[model samples]
Target: MSGTFQDRIPVLLVEIMRKFPEERSESEVLLVHNMLSSVSMFRRYSGTLQLLLARVVRYQRLERRRVVIKKGHWGHSFYFVFSGLLAVTKDNDGSSAFVDKEPILIKKGMSFGDVALIKTLRRNATVVCMEETELMVVDKEDFFANKMDVELKREFDYRFSFFRSLQLVSSWSYSLIEQMADHSKAEQFRYGHVVVKDTNDMGNIIFIGKGQCDVLRVVDLTSCSAYQRLLKQYADSVSRGTCLPTHGFKSELTNQPGSVIKHKVLLNNPPRPPRGLLADLPTSACFLIDTLHQSSTFGLNQYLMPSKQRDCRRFTLVSQSMEIMRVEKTRFDKLVDNTTMKKLEALQKTYPSDDELCTVFLEHSRWKDYKHSVVQDLFPHRVAPIRSPKTQKQQGHCGPSQVLQQTRHVVNRLKQTKQRVEPKDNKIKK
Candidate 1:
């Protein structure tokens, strides 16, 4: 090491540097720099990266075909491919099959085993050397103690609660939920932001952690035309001093006359049983349908089904200042367990029939738009508009005194919930 080369060099060509007998001793430092530069996560924490490389990382040599990692076992180390080739494979059915499914080749300068380490979950795939290989590995203790791992653990813990709130994944165990959180990332959108444009283009499943979204499905002209017809009839009834039938518009309109105008309005709309009134739902009534709220999930159904037979997202998700968690489709497929899949299937089975779902949508929309407006008119003075806490706070009204009161109220509520579910430990799982 005549003149120390502080700059980083390629991992594969480290041997070429060794040829310079003078700089051979500095090869270790060069390799560490290569690892840090190659990984984006490491780049974020240069100080910690340097310290870990110097203190914890160790070089290991493996013969061709030696298993570096095994699926289903707890992940203990994060390995960086320092040199030579490796093959990555996953078990399809968790069986002792000698053959690998969907094998992937990992070459020099690449990293694997970090996903499992990030979540402190079981390995989802196995990695084996394709030839005599050199790897730089940081064991679990050192890996998790790093600042990057701590940050990731904190994020995953926060995200796990959102997964628990969702119906599709609510029943999953903490371990599985943690894995899902590992693959997900938080995203924020302003009001009316189109989260998904073309059905085919959307690649990740979105879970609403906070706020609302309008799920608009493309409807045929016939459906739109029918809804327009209904709106026209309802408008006519309102003008003629006749009430629009409630019970999701299933009842026939009554004949009512206004003061001596001698105007005759024909009511051709027939009365039908509630189940037969699928046309009443907002999905059938308008070109766009607004639905979904906190804890709702979209895009999974498309991913789970085969491409040739997959049902494209019939609905477009437009958010309103929504905070959400999104997991990529490829990651979802790799991580979702059988239990979660079964739960999703069960949820699909529980979906209301087309007609019934539509009726429910109609009932909900009617309550929000028509019913509430009529009620407000009847008791204009009595209906003191309710103010949200957020709105109040935004007006510079949430002072220290008000915050104290809110804190007490929230503490009381938490006391009750805490009786049913104990608080999770702050220590990161490994």
Candidate 2:
């Protein structure tokens, strides 16, 4: 096993080399040049993937202790800090100064206090990173593009995977990963094409599907695999710094344009959300199953507020024949009356904001402009990760009081709606 793992690395390397035809070095890919030509908004914002927004909002750079977002203040937008550092702080102690008393740090690309956007919720914590931080503010409008493209899909997918991995997936068995490449479509890159980059929303979920992406510093070739291995190994060992390398396991995360990143798939499923409501749900939302039909307080609580991501959608789907149903929200209402919708209100509260994750929304936006006719054909069945029922154990997620509260609300609402719709029988008297 150990020998095969080591041998696999080198074999992957040669594949990228043979695959990259035009250039000997990574520098020649003309990433920035090509990007500038490829996108109109690339020049406007230093960061890539800036153009797809249906709109844009600007905010001044924070110098020293600027109040980008106040703890307890509603988070109306997300800031993309282009330059400098911004410290994130919270008013945890109920002190006068939310900043001076207890401040948290927020670095570039890392968002803060986003949970406060919904239902006029107060910012849970205060955040700060550094000074002179230039930020691209994503207001409610720009953040919630009705359409999603490959870019937004990839971003939401990465974030969804990131948070999900933090929970049940870490302990997942290697055998359980269902050879991801089996379903994925393969993409071979020329020396000039980039496979991945920092903040890229290309929707590329690569795995060591087949060949290794022999990576170098654009300055050297023998350094091939050296940079990839070094960064990856460093990420594995480091206590803090960049995001964990696992989210986009097969792709590189960097900002330099033209820096060649290559990918094949271990398991690839192009995203296909139904052309209706559930498909437009914000990225932060997830499903919790009360599959057993048990009225147990614990079971009910667990499904009440799914505060974290989970592997399965509450129900343990065994048979493959139970087809996926993609109904429009209206169609859903028509199929199941108000009795069936009692649980949804509880689920919807967790994701208080209507704002879809910026990445997910962005991907939808880009998908509209795609020229490939086959692209629209993708995303029929999504084999989301399923936790093994035998080995899996319920963690008892929600509080008893919360469960009671939600249960009462659902039961009451269902009763009221049923009563209001009841028809009177006047014809019998006539």
Candidate 3:
């Protein structure tokens, strides 16, 4: 089946190219193919069916804030994001989708309008282009012609079931849970991959549907009490002349004819001690603060906390072969009522302040530089010497040509002395 599918891809791609009005590179077509593969609606289909779907999918470009589908309108097409962002809103009116309520952002590799197309019902929600978006569109006629809608209902059902099992959304109404499932996209991450970065501004809430993840914090170890003791030990080593070696002046002498020349290279500046001397002391490190398992949700604190307080601490979520259901924070905030928001806020976890850690790192760096300066001042001998070009020239430095000339003159004198000694020895033998 796989080999047959592989063999058909080239022929299918040629058909896809004909569907597009403008020329598309092989890479661009392949990108569209990958995007189609990522869509949840297409995942259940066989490779051959997916390739067939690819042939019928047409390219579309929509400007920012354009409404692709409105609530209560007959669904005519299904969309897969080729590039750019889109928003799905519950609002019937197009204007309110972006103004009154925050809409769920649909990013690249995601699809929309499948629910309405599959059920053959009017679009219950509105979808608008958030930016200049490039989409691969499948018309209702083509969508159903291939029987692509068959497993779409089942996919949604599975998502709805998954949401129902979560205690976090247990208080939510059935309609709300269903809506959440519709907007949420399942994403996978490899083990040890960063699912969410420290203090991410995007503020997308992630629910761990399967596997595990770790919550990590970057810590500045200079603030620790143990570091203070180590700093004292370093200071003692510096004072006792054991921390670094002393710098020495280099001198070279050259004798030619009646004159003796001396090249005195002075040690002007000393080399700074290696930072690795404090290798035992870590300036910064990452600490595993907590681990999240199945059904655990994160990225809520940013929504609950005030802007000033939101990013005070740095928290990163790293995945361990995890599958996650992610929803935009703005959409989440719009979905829940004031009471639910309060409940979520109450469950917000606090972490150590990143500001304090930054301050500790800065203070330690300054102290390190200050300690180096003090060592140079008190124990001047330990500092390495620097040779200045201007000083060398002023001290009658020997040029390469002059040195070669002097060497030749010395060789000739030795040869003349040898010749005179040889003739005297010959006379003695006679």
* Top candidate when judged by TM-score against the true structure: 3
Instruction: Please report the candidate that would top lDDT against the real structure.
Output: 3
Error of 2 at 186 (Å): 16
TM-score on alpha carbons, each prediction? 0.37, 0.27, 0.55
Q: List the residue pairs that clash in candidate 3.
A: 269-384, 270-383, 270-384, 271-384
lDDT of 2: 0.31
Write the residue-wise lDDT of candidate 1 on 1-430 in tens digits: 1112332234454443333223334555565565556543343233444444434566576877778888888988887665577777775332322355545677666667877776578988777776777676777775555555765556667788778766776666887777787666566667755676555676677787888665543332223333445566666876797856554332111111100011111111323323433443222221133345777667754345566765443445656668788777777777676777877753331111223323333434444456656866798888566889987555433222222222232223323433332234211010
Give candidate 2 regions above 4 Å deviation: 1-50, 92-122, 145-212, 215-430
Global Cα lDDT for candidate 1 = 0.52
Instruction: Give one digit per residue, the lDDT tens place, for model 3 in 46-106.
Output: 4555665665688676888888999999878888775677877877656665675556678
Q: Rate the local accuracy (lDDT) of all candidates.
A: 0.52, 0.31, 0.58
Clashing residue pairs for model 1: none
Weakest 10 consecutive residues of candidate 1 by summed lDDT: 252-261
